[model samples]
Target: MPDGYSTLHPAMHGMVNIGVRAARRAGEIMVRHLNRLESLEVIEKGRNEFVSAVDRLAEEAVIEVIRDHYPEHAILGEESGASGDHEYQWIIDPLDGTTNYLHGFPVYAVSIAVAQAGTLKHGVVYDPLRQEIFTASRGQGAQLDGRRIRVSKQISLRGALLATGFPYRITASRTDTYLDMLRAVLIETAGVRRLGSAALDLCYVAAGRVDGFWELGLQKWDIAAGTLIIREAGGRISDFNGTDAFIESGDLVAGTPKVYAALSKLLAPYARGL
Candidate 1:
């Protein structure tokens, strides 16, 4: 399996062989592009929609490493839409926070996920600035730089610090969905933060830095990789409506079991139904 697809869930042999190699390769390229000395060309796809040359270069680097090994694996990325022809796909955010990167905010990351038959099996979220790497494989639990990590054990929203992300495309059609959630979390939780980077937001949830996270109008690239990391870290994830429609609808909430329940209740008022 040149693309690492044949390794599937990793047989103890391929775990270190393929997954680690791909992740380290992606991280290397990420560092190369994010050196901050390169001439970054920021382009806006919409009002706040941003893409940069670094994004494309980063994606190309990841694509090459993944494709060279698994030419059959499909790839769904932010800068480059979708490609390849395989049942298993690699979802990626070459640069998870282009805005933050452009502004030198030191909060961007590279998120990578592998899914088979639409089920996420493995994920990697790397923060180049911190050189921190988070990884997860189905039933294997989550790990940060090879050490196991788990979500916080917080039991209630009142005691939990939560994270969230709002779509830059928040038009009139989606305004209330954003504002209502913000207000609900603000009133019910200890604190609320809009980190702008969905990947890091979910990573924080998995790492226990934040007890919970939710967002509306996200894409696969934004949450796919981080979602697996959360689940494998002993966290729970669901749509705003408490369904497994996070990927399909791009509406999601994730946290430790207790925090998720509390936050879900707080968000109930604004959700579709009672």
Candidate 2:
């Protein structure tokens, strides 16, 4: 365990510790299989969405840990569907950025979050390539490798560097809508980046690496951990309509309060009727 783990909020110490362990275990599986892509079995979940053997193995690793310590806790994982109906649910994205991983891009991650009675309580996002762990508990501030972190203080959109992602299923209507939002932000901000991992993008926002981020069509496991981390790091996240239902809507815009507000305003016209 890292020294920062010692500084976690006392009340959430157990859950955070368990989440970190599970994430690291899954991350290890990803790292071990990262270079051996030729043997991996890949499946196309949808038009452009993919899953691989590593995803299943990593997800199993995560679930094994959770089940070992908390058998009654439910699980909602990307590779595996939901299981065990319980008040305590663990949302797991065993391997985020699978496409990047398969291409040896070194941008993938393991994300895990625990919700108690429908409210997010603890979250962890581990980038095994960099060995960086971003974590947060409901009331405790967010941290990176044990050091506290916060969103960028940039107050204006013109000077902010933003991140976003294009949906996998790019229908004609979806493409036009996404492009409109992209163009609006591209013209106003320092630049826009598509990192292919929403979990890491939100962690970047929490760590001040990027000023803000927005994307549509993300899953619960993708944004669950990252959103909680962002909030704990003095950031705001919301759906296109500036509401707190982003997890349900899967359209999120997150950043420092000022940047979030400005970014949302910029995309408002394009998001009308969404």
Candidate achieving the largest TM-score = 2
lDDT of 1 by residue, 151-242 (tens): 99899888779998876665665776778778878888889887778999999999999999988778888888899899999999998777
Any idea what lDDT model 2 has?
0.89
Stretches of candidate 1 exceeding 4 Å from the true structure: 1-20, 33-38
Worst 10 residues of 1 by lDDT: 1-10
Choose the strongest candidate by lDDT. Answer: 2
lDDT of 2 by residue, 26-141 (tens): 88898888668988999999988889999999999999988988999999999889999999999999999989988888798999999998899999999988888899999989
Clash numbers, per candidate: 4, 0
Q: Which ranges of candidate 2 are over 4 A from the true structure?
A: 1-12
Worst lDDT run of 10 residues, candidate 2, spans: 3-12
Candidate 1 global Cα RMSD = 4.1
Question: Could you tell me the TM-score of candidate 2?
Answer: 0.95
